[model samples]
Target: MRITVWDLPLRLFHWLLAAAVAGALITINLGVSWIEWHARFGLAVVGLIAFRLVWGVVGSTHSRFASFVPTPSAVASYVRGHWRQPGHNPLGALSVYAMLGLFGFQAVSGLFTTDEIAFSGPLTRAVSSDLVATLSRLHRQTEWWLYLLLGLHVLSIIVYRLRGIKLVGPMIHGRKEVDQTVPQPRGGGVLAFIIAVGIAAAAVWLANGSWIPVPPPAPAPAW
Candidate 1:
């Protein structure tokens, strides 16, 4: 029997976010010419993250934050190989949250990050140079954590595949082959999704400093 584990919105969000993040990283290594594209990718990322956060509150059964939050016993049970579910397992849930949290931090920090040249975050004008400097440094340094998280994610996928557990297929097509009976997700309809997207769009606009006041340009120094 077929059951929906991931929904269309969730799947699209997942893939788009992955592409955006990867693109942003790649563009970072391409120098000044690509910074504009990098900023566009960052905007997409922020919007996606905002959507995901809102959707977590009112999304499909498996996609909700409540669905994947792991308890102590849940972790122990997973470690003991006694945990079974149609959605994310306990260990996987931790990775999901860690990715969301860290990415959220990255998006927020990047709002004030600067390149000390032609590139400046849209919101840089709203913050002090010292604060921007700090965030910029942190942003540069914390990317390694994202790399570590990505490494662990791929490792876990390989580990699961070796164990005869197929996790990736359901994310792509929203159906999984489970021997046990599980309820299909019922939330995340068009209306709820529209609301989530609206929220995300607004967040992106704000992140771009659409409403923030820009400081006046400094006068040119006389030679």
Candidate 2:
């Protein structure tokens, strides 16, 4: 039987977030000139994550955190080969949660980071210098952790493929072929999508420091 395992919004969110993260990583390494683009990509990540967090609550059955969150018993059951579930398994759910949390931290931290030359984060001026320095250091150091997590994510997909499970296809198309019947994903209709998008836009705007009132031209540079 074929079942809908991922909703359209969830599928789009997954791919778009992947592209945004990739762009961020690439532009960050392309030298100081690309810092602005890097920041833009980071903001995109922030927005996407915000969307995901909201969607995880109001999203479809399979996409909701309640559906696949890894509990101790669930993990033990899966480890004992007694658990057969659709969408993410216990270990996969753990990975998903970890990635979401780490990336969220990375994106939020970038909003206060500075290069001490060019490329200051949008929220840098809103925070104290000491806090900015700490976040900046963390932002730089967490890059390796991102790389490690990404590597593990890809490697897990490859391992699953070798074991004859077509994990990637379902993510791309939102459907999976299962031997047994599974409940189709529900909810996350237009209203939920709109709410998620609105929240994401608000997060982007806030992360851009739109609320930080700009000083008025420094009083025309008093002579």
Best model number under lDDT: 2
TM-score of 1: 0.94
lDDT of 1 by residue, 116-206 (tens): 9889999998988899999999999999999999899989989989999887888899888777887778898989999999999999999
- Model 2 off-target regions past 4 Å? 216-223
RMSD of each: 1.8, 1.5
List the lowest-lDDT window of 10 residues for candidate 1: 176-185
Please give, for residues 31-124, the per-residue lDDT of candidate 2 as tens digits: 9999999999999999999999999999999889999979999999999988878878999999999999999999999999998999789999
**Residue 5 lDDT, candidate 1, scale 0-100:** 88
TM-score of model 2 vs. true structure:
0.96
